[model samples]
Target: MPIRTEIVSQDRIVYQGDADMVVLPGIDGVMGILPNHSPVLTALQYGIITVRLKGEEYYFTVAGGFVEVQPDQVTVLADAAENVAEIDVARAEAAKTRAEEMLKEGIPSDQDRYLMIQAALRRSTLRIDAVRRYQQGRRSRG
Candidate 1:
């Protein structure tokens, strides 16, 4: 069975289609959804959403949001999202490095800097995952 998915952002819909399964980055952790799963709504985390469609894998990086599963239909109201194909690996790598430096310097003792660093790390990880997936797709295609 297939589940309908809709990935949304404030500006537009990132994706919508039928998928065999969806792997989400939940606030608590990652979770997989399939057809006939129990209904529930939960908050999202910065991470990857993997979709299995027609035997091919697709990946999207979502920066937090909400997820609603109603029967076989799963909808994700993502705060921000980008497909793997859209990621800029160099930028993501730089962000990751900066976040690591901030984490090490401990300048967040007074500011939200620490929290922002954590957020940057999450975003960087999401981008890295997306880039890896895209590269894997390229390799598989070739």
Candidate 2:
């Protein structure tokens, strides 16, 4: 059986198609969905979302969102979302370095800035993980 999945952000629809399974980063924890799943809705936290279709896999980094699962469909609406192919490795690396520097500074007096930096770190790390996995696949094929 095939399950329909869609990933949407505030500004755009990042992905939409058929999938065999989906692993989502939920607020409470990670959740997996397959065809004919019971309907449910849950808040999302900053993390990665993985979708499997046929024999292929796809990955996306999402910064918070809500997921709704119906009998045959899964929809994720995120504050922001990016796929591995869409990620800029250089930008993600820079953000990771900047976040590390901010953390080393002891978070200072700005709580919001600290949290923002932390979120950036998480997002960047997710991207890096996905990209690295893709690179590994390329290496094996080469």
TM-scores for candidates 1 onward, in order: 0.78, 0.83
Q: Show the colliding residue pairs in model 2.
A: none
Candidate topping lDDT? 2
- What is residue 100's positional error in candidate 2, in angstroms? 2.2
Best by TM-score: 2
- Alpha-carbon deviation at 6 in model 1, angstroms: 0.7
> How far is 35's C-alpha from truth in model 2 (Å)?
1.6
lDDT of 2 by residue, 61-142 (tens): 7889799999899999998888766788999899899999889978768878877888888888877876887654321100
State how far residue 75 of model 2 sits from its true place (Å). 0.6
Residue-wise C-alpha lDDT for candidate 1, range 1-142, written one tens digit per residue: 7998888877887778888898999988899999888998999988788888788887788999999998879999988887777678999999999899878876678567677788789889878877875776631110
